[model samples]
Structure formats: C-alpha cells, structure tokens
Target: MADEIKPAAQQQVQIPVDVSNRETVYANFVQAHLNADEVYLELGQFSQVVTPTGPDPIVLSHRVIMNFVTAKRLADLLRRAVSQHEQMFGVVEVDPNRRLRVQQPPV
Candidate 1:
C-alpha cells in the first residue's frame, strides 16, 4: 500500500467569453509592427479620397498589441482557419486584379 501510486482527478476548466459589449469593425487593411518584445497590429479600412490623383487613405479602426508568443500562436491559428476555408470552398485570391480577371468572360 505504501508503494502504490494514486491517480489524480482530472478536471476541465471552462473559460467564459463575454460578447455583450463587443463591437465589430470591418478591416480591409492591416499593418503590423514589432519591437523588441511585442507585436502591434493596426487594423484599418481603405477609403478613396474624392480626388483621383491622391493615394487612398487607410482609416485605422483598432490596434492589438501582444507578445511574440501570442502573435505566433495567432498566426498559426489563422493559417489553419484559412486552410480549412480553402478546403471547403476554393483558393482565396488576395489580388484584386487576378480575381477580376478570373471573373471576366473570354472575349
């Protein structure tokens, strides 16, 4: 009895997410910056100025700052999600010009 090992009880911890006060913002632009210890993500939307001669502006909506480890984990999670989405649907084209070309009919 003295030399017998006892198994510890396994418990599952539940983490609750509160979305009551959550606000959603759409972002078509993302700029990433990093320092010695942290990563900064600036989410924004691209809007065209009234004039056709000027470059479009990116209106920053939100910024997320996290450590390198969290950033790497997020990158992996995003990759997996995108892979799953591509598998279910099709390859997502990031280039707008290419997408337009693919949608065009042969002349």
Candidate 2:
C-alpha cells in the first residue's frame, strides 16, 4: 500500500514597525549636535536627489556627513557620495582640492 500523505497548513502574521519622518530625524540630530567642537569633522557627503520635472530634472537630495573614522574619512565620503548619485540635475562632481585624492580614482 502507498504511504499516506497530507498537505501542510498555512498561517498569516502581522508585524508592526516604527516609521520615523526623515525631516524630523534630521532636525533632532541637528539639535543634538548643535554648537559643539567635540564633534570632529570626519567625513561628509553632498548629494542632489532629483525627480522628473517636465523636460528637465529637479534637485532632490543634498546631504552631508560629518562623522566617521579619521585620516581617510574625507576621501572615503567623497568617493562614496558621488557613487550613489543620480543624473537628475547635471554632472555632479566634487572639487576636493586635495593633493592625494586628486591622483586616486573617483572610487
């Protein structure tokens, strides 16, 4: 005789997540880091987030960072930021008037 078999049952589940407003987060962070020199300038980024606006694109993201390891943070930030950039505005380039980075690749 063939072995008896049965199909598996299915179940549904629901999960909750805390959604934070991006703008609010930024504001809070700023308030915390305001007027301080202990906050060393490690790294930062400047981005331009763009959206489709008729024939031309619109600027959307313009971000900057200032927290990370030292000695290589500046270069690392610049390299990373441009890599994640989108072509909504125009050729986005960083003029990092540095002696070392000028020789390394954008990456």
Candidate 3:
C-alpha cells in the first residue's frame, strides 16, 4: 500500500498553548531597547499630564526580552492584527490630540 502525501498547510501541526498562570497587564506605552543580540521591550502605562516641569512619566509594568528574529515575528503579527481590526472597524488614530478632539462633545 502507498502512503498519501499532504500539502504544506495540511502537513502543519497544531501546538497546544497553556495559559494557566499567565498574568495580564495593560500597557498604553512601550519602549524598546536593543543591544548586540537581544531586544528589550518595556511595557508601561503612560500618565498623560501637562506640567511646567517636563513630559509625563510612564510607569513600567512588564519587560519582555527576545532575540531579533522573534522580535521581527512579533512585529509582523502585530501589524496583521492591527490591519484586521482596522478592516473590521475603521482606521485607528495614533495621534493623542486627534483622538481627544474626535471624542470631544459639541458645545
């Protein structure tokens, strides 16, 4: 008897994910630092406040360190996700001032 061959997509195996002890953190801001080999992504919440002193501070919550290859993959995944979301709803505004203006009520 001859064995049947499958296509590339069909040959792919599904990997099970375990999220039993995952801690979820909400980060409105992220800072990236890179060295010779690895990249450090610091996720934090930005406190928007206008002061005479200087710019607002970001309280960091989580820090994820990954290699360059993994970082590129993560970037691609994020881009795809944002594209899908925009297609379903509308274009997301990245400018904070523009967003605030859109949300303002008419006098």
lDDT of 2 by residue, 1-107 (tens): 99888876776878877678544312111111312323332222224344475333322233343443442566687667766664444445445455235455577
18-90, model 3: which lDDT tens digit per residue? 9999998899999999999999999999888869997687799899999999999999999999999999998
Could you give candidate 1's per-residue lDDT for residues 9-32 as a string of tens digits? 898999999999999999989999
Ranking by lDDT: 3, 1, 2
Task: Give the Cα lDDT of each candidate.
Answer: 0.90, 0.43, 0.91
Query: Which of the predicted structures, 1 or 3, would earn the higher TM-score when compared with the native?
Result: 1
Which structure is stronger by TM-score: 1 or 2? Answer: 1
Mark the regions of model 2 whose C-alpha exceeds 4 Å error after superposition.
21-57, 62-107
State in Å the error of residue 4, model 1.
Answer: 13
TM-score computed on alpha carbons, candidate 1 = 0.75
Model 1 regions lying over 4 Å from their true place: 1-11, 48-50, 103-107
True-vs-predicted CA distance for residue 32, candidate 1, Å:
0.3
Predicted structure 2, TM vs. truth: 0.20
Screening candidate 2 with a backbone cut-off below 3 angstroms (N, C-alpha, C), the clashing residue pairs are 44-65, 45-65, 49-60, 49-61
CA shift of 42, model 3, Å: 0.6
Error of 2 at 92 (Å): 34
How many clashing residue pairs appear in each of the predictions shown? 0, 4, 0
